[model samples]
Target: MNHDGLRFGNLDYMQIAWSEVTPGEVHASWSGHLTACGESVIKAKPVYDSRVRDITCAECGATAVFDLGTAREKAKAITEKYEATGSLSRADAVSLRETALQTIAPQAFKARRAGDSWNAISSNYLMSTGAATETDGTSILVGRVGLAVIEGLEVSEYQGGY
Candidate 1:
């Protein structure tokens, strides 16, 4: 697939998707830094480390996650739990997103630092990173970015394919 190139700076995390059949014409994104909490998320190395971080702050120091498949599933489960109980609240939602964010940071970090690589089909491609090398809120790896077509905030077509 061909992409027009996307960039995120000062973005702890981002979720991207297409809005219609027009490919990239209709795009949408949600920020990790501003989602449920104001904290910036970290992308770290190794799945184990990422999982640890997402499960607890002592391990990850982040409040949200991105790109980790397992973490995403867990986040969904958390949301389901909230809905099932009919006790959904702002705090509950925040807590679920926070847990998922923290849990996936390490995996995202590892992906960016290790096995993950960017492939641009166009000649004018310019992939860049605005993250810091240190572990602090001042910096963070870009979180999970997926391509999907959504309608009314509900996923209609997911192009990320995992």
Candidate 2:
């Protein structure tokens, strides 16, 4: 009998919460599903305003346009470790996750195991020193790394370089 379609009666879930790091940066998270949903649809909250100054027309106060390059860069890396017996384990995934969630933004970060993979849903960026307006002030915004992530995945018993 094929037991592949049967529901194993367990679901993997993880979540990160909202917190204020600085005036310009706020951290928040939502529940993530692995077994059922391959990826979580997380609405990206406002990240850093990568602008130094706002340009307006002095003659009539009309809106001006400026070249704003890419808000964030794509950063990704993968690492794998093995046990003494040369078997893939959850620890490797944990280490990879930690390494992946390094910067403030994770546009392309992913870690996979035998049956599960952790991927960054959206762009998470950081704020650098830039210009500001008199009214808006210097309210910068950054992105979220990940929520309360878990590293419990069932992988094969074979170790390989990540």
Candidate 3:
């Protein structure tokens, strides 16, 4: 009856506190009957494991996976381009970022309704452009942006409020 839900990108997974003792027998808090093995499984402890990463959606039967490394790489590339050009305005940067996101996740960026636009659900952050001193007193300029990829898309502008 009571469970937790997790979202990654456009995918969602439910943490149902239940256990299966047989092929057709499942013990959970929602069901009053126990498993065929007579195991009284109630709200069990939720296990967070990478092996069970993907979950099928009950409504549409779609699977979604979250890859942070890929997102970071994309963000880094955008920031590096801005740093190289040195003439990118705020509007241009936002447009570039949104375009990149749309290219990355086309299915997730698909419009759900008529006259809908795909926009970022996450916060837009500015990239850092400064030199860093290493331990050996060497200066290095890295184009880094502590920005996460947009997880969800909506029919609205992501960077409208200035």
Output the number of the TM-score-best candidate: 3
lDDT of each: 0.29, 0.21, 0.31
Instruction: Give the residue spans of candidate 2 off by over 4 A.
Output: 1-20, 29-93, 101-162
The regions of model 3 sitting more than 4 angstroms off are: 1-6, 9-63, 68-73, 107-162
Q: Whose lDDT is greatest here?
A: 3
Return the TM-score for each candidate structure: 0.25, 0.19, 0.26
Sorted by TM-score (best first), the order is 3, 1, 2
Between candidates 2 and 3, the one scoring higher on lDDT is: 3
Position 88, candidate 1: lDDT: 64
**What's the CA error at residue 118 for candidate 1, in Å?**
11
Tens digit of lDDT per residue, candidate 3, span 1-162?
Answer: 111122233221223233344333222222223311234555432333211122112111111232333553555565566656775655755555554443433233223212233332221222111222232211121213322333322322122211
RMSD for each model, in Å, please? 18.6, 20.9, 16.0
Sort by lDDT, best first: 3, 1, 2
**Model 3 lDDT at residue 110:** 29
| Clash list (residue pairs), candidate 2 | 15-148, 16-147, 16-148, 48-141, 52-131, 105-124
